[model samples]
Target: MMRHPFVLFALGTFAVFLLLHLAGGRQYVGVLSGTVVGGAGGAGLGLLYALAWFGAVLAAPVLLLAGLLDGALARASRARP
Candidate 1:
């Protein structure tokens, strides 16, 4: 399971997002809403946070599904004697 590339990618994406979120990335995300929590310097941080967030939201699910399909195909192939 862990050997699957898609799964690894999804997990990695989620982990990065989790780390950023834990480190107060949420505050920076307000930049998107015109809040500007930390001024100009924060804009970059907010962008990073936003990218990670979007990746986790958009790519993660597709990666997970690809991983699942890959795993299932591998299993099916192995079962064919």
Candidate 2:
């Protein structure tokens, strides 16, 4: 699983999202609703947090599926001969 590039990428994406969320990153996400929680410096951080959330929500599952498929195919091919 971890040997596959897609899997590793998905894991990395999820890890980043988790870390940010744990570090009170969600406060920044309020920016999306025009709430701006942390002031001037927080805008960029908010954008980053939003992007990370999107990536975790949208890209991570696809990546994990791709990785699983790739790993299965590799194993099947190796076992054939």
Query: What's the lDDT for all of these models?
Result: 0.88, 0.86
In candidate 2, where is summed lDDT lowest over 10 consecutive residues?
A: 37-46
Best by TM-score: 2
Per-candidate count of clashing residue pairs (backbone under 3 Å): 0, 0
TM-scores of the models, in the order given: 0.86, 0.89
Candidate 1 local lDDT, 21-66, one digit each (tens) = 8888778877888888888878778878899999999999999999
* Per-residue lDDT over 1-81 for candidate 2, one digit per residue giving the tens place of the 0 to 100 score: 258989999999999989888877878877888888779768767888789899999999999999999899988999996
Which segments of candidate 2 are over 4 A away from where they belong?
Answer: none
Q: Estimate the TM-score for candidate 1.
A: 0.86
Which one is best on lDDT? 1
